[model samples]
Target: MTSRAAGASLPGLTGTPLDPDQEEARRLLQEELDSGDYRVEESWLVRLWRWFTDLLPDPASFGPLPGWSTWAILGVVGAAVVAGVLFVTRDRWRAARLSPTGPAGAVLDGMRRSAADYRSAAREAMDAGRLDDAVLEAYRAIAAGAIERTLLEDRPGRTAHEVALELGPTFVDSADALRRAGDVFDAVRYGDHRASTDQARAVLELEARLAQARPELGADRHPGLVVPS
Candidate 1:
């Protein structure tokens, strides 16, 4: 009896008949392997490439989104971004609005009083034992000094606290004093707390300091001033 050779192809295995499509696929696969395009599964680069390809969107499998829906999604995202920006910048915008150069200052175009007058009034009030009036006048003197130095612009209806807030940056060295004077003025003018001669004197001292002080060069300048935009 004759036996088949060890390398001989069998009909059930290597010699099985292939359809046209299968034959073409096998031929393409062989060509790819010969051209070094076929990578082994054990290769790290091959695994990484497969992972990256899997993560990509399948355009053919998933239908494209409608134009309106896409636009709506984009619009919502854009609006959210704008809202976030506005929220972050709300304080800055408010500061700019309340600035001497802003609309807040427009109404008080010519309503500014001289610092000397305010100081004189403060001294008179102090001599008269009217601590409340002295505090108010002293605080006004500080504001007047700020205006004279162009560190602030006069605006009507602005509270003492508001003025201090605006001038705090301009008087970095005297920021605490300005704020304290504002608080004292507010307490005497608005609150039920009565002003004392000491408090009035403190405000006067702060006013003197502010009057002698120069404008901070690095301070945020008014928009009307010729500053680097």
Candidate 2:
């Protein structure tokens, strides 16, 4: 619609009555929106949707979000960046909690040692047909290792999701081992669930490999471990 044609009669975004500039903006926005799907063309609406989707609020910012002022928008972006950093810095958080070194290498060291002890305990328990103890031991081992290696200083800890993030791809193999063991451990611990001998064996093997591999890599933190520490 022409700017003049799409007058006060046009619907405002919130369905409120249109003011002159609003109507004009809406008309312009509408025109941009109506420019057809950005499919092959990437319409302005699609771009706006993408932009807005990217503009999430900070967790610390709480609620009562405002209109897109430069500062508010910047806040949203800053929040997103902070969230990303926190996510990626999870290993550092855990390590700091444990060793005060915030060193990924040290954390991994702890994880490996912990994993070995847990695996041994779990194997013994599983062999004796004590599923409950095996499961419990598995988790305890991981937690202890995480504390010693990842969060030693912060006994009785928090989420490792944040900590695993800071670890580089090299650390991923060990992390994967921890995650797999964790899953099986959960199934056994959280319920009266039964795992087959094969499943239990798999979990043990993964944990063992992770434990061994971690120490071999040495305590040198990956450059990607992100040190300001």
Candidate 3:
């Protein structure tokens, strides 16, 4: 009789099963091969390019248009896309220009309302129990009142913190309060925190005190002048 090789099954035992260890190993190898974890993802720029190309009219549908014509069409579409991007981000660009040196979200966009108007609005909001709105409007009143009184220059990109620091020397007694008020304003305006009644009252009281206090503007009165902490 011919000798069979080790671990080799004879023709009569073709149905022989693998050992438990071998079966488990086979399963683990198969799983590793089938997993999607190793697949490389396409970069965003590549995806964007694919999307743009997909949006273009099929050249075949254009009835054998000249190569130059195809390029010209692509140029027009590209220009339109660029224009749309700029239009959508126009506000951010304006904000950047207005506040190149200020903190993020600190840009005081040009407000059409005067300081008195903001103060009145803040009071109304407070009475109506809109603490958040009261805080916002009261901070605006502080900024606007300073600008109106020439304590702060009415520049396009002036921020709340900048206003506080600039007016620190002028309002020596309330310097820390001004800084804290600025913090409260930023928290309500940009942070996830909501304004509480106490915070609203604090801002309102600060605004009132600032209104009553006279600013000491001297020969050094100018923009970008910050008091040292």
Candidate 4:
């Protein structure tokens, strides 16, 4: 009898058997569904169908937009913004582009021009016997020398003071000389005092020394790029 019962159990194993937990879960799900466990959503498809049937107008009656215009409103706004930005940045951009670039020749050319200007001014001042004007030209010359000969490059980024400071101790004596020259000129011109011939000679000699110091500061020369001095 046990052999017969084993044979029956083997046949049942060959077929799929229902799990007790799964069977219980299925029964609970069916009961919940029968009692309406889920909330029903409104049928969007039915609503859309009803709207199309009841509310949609004939396509042939539809007209184009009222203004019959293209390139309206936003185009004007975009153009105005672009124009404004260009107008604002125009001068600065031009200045930046035309500003000096690289070193050597550029710096030299600028220096040459500056030197010519100062010399012209100095000569005029000398002719007029205006000591103050002469002193200003002398200072201008020093500043020009510092930028043109001392800097490896003549780009627009550096200021006079910065160049002067970078020149180390050499600038000290030169700056003092020019500054004293200015004072001497101020005294001679405004205070009704006269700068003696010796004083004029000393000022010119100091100017020469400062010019000499400029090229010395550019000791660390670069062929085509900016160099540290």
lDDT per residue for candidate 3 within 54-104, as digits (tens), equals 987787875877769867987997887788679989989744433324234
TM-score of each: 0.47, 0.36, 0.50, 0.33
The segments of candidate 3 whose C-alpha lies over 4 angstroms from its true place after superposition are: 1-103, 219-229
The stretch of ten residues in a row with the least summed lDDT in candidate 4 is 102-111
lDDT of 1 by residue, 58-149 (tens): 64665876678667755765676568669989989744433333122221124566889889999999999999888888888777766666
Candidate number with the higher lDDT (1 or 3): 3
Task: Kindly give the number of clashing pairs for every candidate.
Answer: 0, 13, 0, 1
Q: RMSDs, each prediction?
A: 18.6, 19.3, 17.0, 22.5
The lDDT per prediction is: 0.67, 0.52, 0.76, 0.51
Q: On a 0 to 100 scale, what is the lDDT of residue 104 in model 2?
A: 18
Tell me which of candidates 1 and 4 scores higher on lDDT.
1
Candidate 1, residue 51: the lDDT equals: 67
| Model 4: per-residue Cα lDDT over 116-161, one tens digit each | 5775676577567765556546545655655555442454544333
lDDT by residue for model 2 (1-229), tens = 5664544355434433345576677776777577674427678656755776666556456665555665876787668766866898898864333331221112222344554577578889888987666655654555555444542234333323333333224356566655544545444544344666765666556544534444323345432222212
Candidate with top TM-score is 3
Q: Which ten residues in a row have the lowest lDDT in candidate 2?
A: 100-109
Candidate 1 Cα errors over 4 Å, as ranges:
1-112, 218-229
